[model samples]
Target: MSVKEQVCSLSIGIVLFPNVTQLDFTGTYEVFARLPNAQLYLLAQTLEPIRSDGGLTFLPDTTFTQAPALDVLFVPGGPGINGKMEDEKFLEFLKIQGKQARYVTAVCTGSLLLAAAGLLQGYRATTHWLSLDLLEMLGVETVAERVVIDRNRITGSGVTAGIDFGLALAAELFGDAIAQAIQLGIEYNPQPPFNSGSPQTAPAPVLARVTAASQNVQEIRRQIVQRVVTQLQTTNKLNHIYFA
Candidate 1:
């Protein structure tokens, strides 16, 4: 059956953190928002406005505590993920809701948050090409594809790939026709100014510069991962105690 025919009410919760890449969220939003009977909520720690990595600002609809039950949960990625990885409250909230959400989705480095929440351990997933190896370090089997779907989790690569992730998810939830309609509505056309989306395609100098630019971000992410690992260990210890 088609999604429109089967779904009575579908609510999507999109987690927003400071410095989130706008395209990561908006690309998916454009597709899911167009679903016939879908509701979208911008979820954050506060209902106030948050700024994007590119200077855009968005106001969240609800705080984590106030968010309604969601059929799907989306986490978008950006530089801000470095800080969020170490956030106890944010990680705890994800651990709780992500376990119960019907579909958990992430774009770009957002999959890092899922790993931090202990949801992606031993799961197959994908993320921004630059961060793909990082997922493996967190116990996720990394895929190089633009989108990866493993059971209830859907993960996308890079910022713009969110659109593909959304369309794929649309196909999963509704039907192929619905995804095609949305794709047509959006006039999804790709005409990059340069053929340098990947290091293999880019010039050596360009690739070197890109790698240099990310060094600091990578260092910060390393610290965040360490903190998350520590938190997970603690959680595991507590679980053992409770069970014992």
Candidate 2:
């Protein structure tokens, strides 16, 4: 009898909303795609091509309605998330899929969507430094760390932090050696041109610019959370759900 080769495959679903931050998804994808037994899908609301904030366009392999069961679900953040929170269809989809996914991860502002979907209540998470304060509005404990792992939900701080998040995730799923090998393969060394990653370290002038640029997004996020909270209250879902 001939010996048979055993193959293992893990299905991963990445939600690609319009204007999503490219690095948020790409960095994670680069790590996960290299796994020995993994199948990746670029999922979206529609099957049409979606554009990223950085002008990259990608065609989704599956849509919300047609997607298969996913072992891991990834959500990336960008300005487009401002609209998704209030989108009943999208939120409903997230609610359903999130409950079924083995692992749910978000990068950058993507945590905002997860929070909007009622997945982050009572859980600790992190997002872009500029948006960390907003997590509290949703009743989530905000962590100032680069990566936060709360139960099955793993959240990364900002765009570049996704790389670290991915490596951590890989280690969780496989082993430390696997993650180390992948990190080495990708040459994951960092050297920032400017020190503006955090409020504590960034210069006052740089911090001011960051705050100014984030003001519009912050205001929009506030409004969206208010609306979602009202809806949850009306439906009597707030009592059963923990916001923080």
Alpha-carbon TM-score of each model against the true structure = 0.94, 0.91
Clashes per candidate (backbone, < 3 Å):
1, 2
Q: How well is each residue in 132-223 modelled by candidate 2, as lDDT tens digits? A: 87777777899988889988889999998899999988877877898899999999988889776788999998889988987887887788
What is the C-alpha lDDT profile of model 1 across 22-57, one tens digit per residue? Answer: 999998999998987899999999977899999999
Can you tell me which runs of candidate 2 are displaced by over 4 Å? 1-7, 237-244
lDDT of 1 at 36: 70
lDDT of 2 at 126: 95
For residue 134, what is the lDDT in candidate 2?
A: 74
Clashing residue pairs, candidate 2? 122-244, 139-244
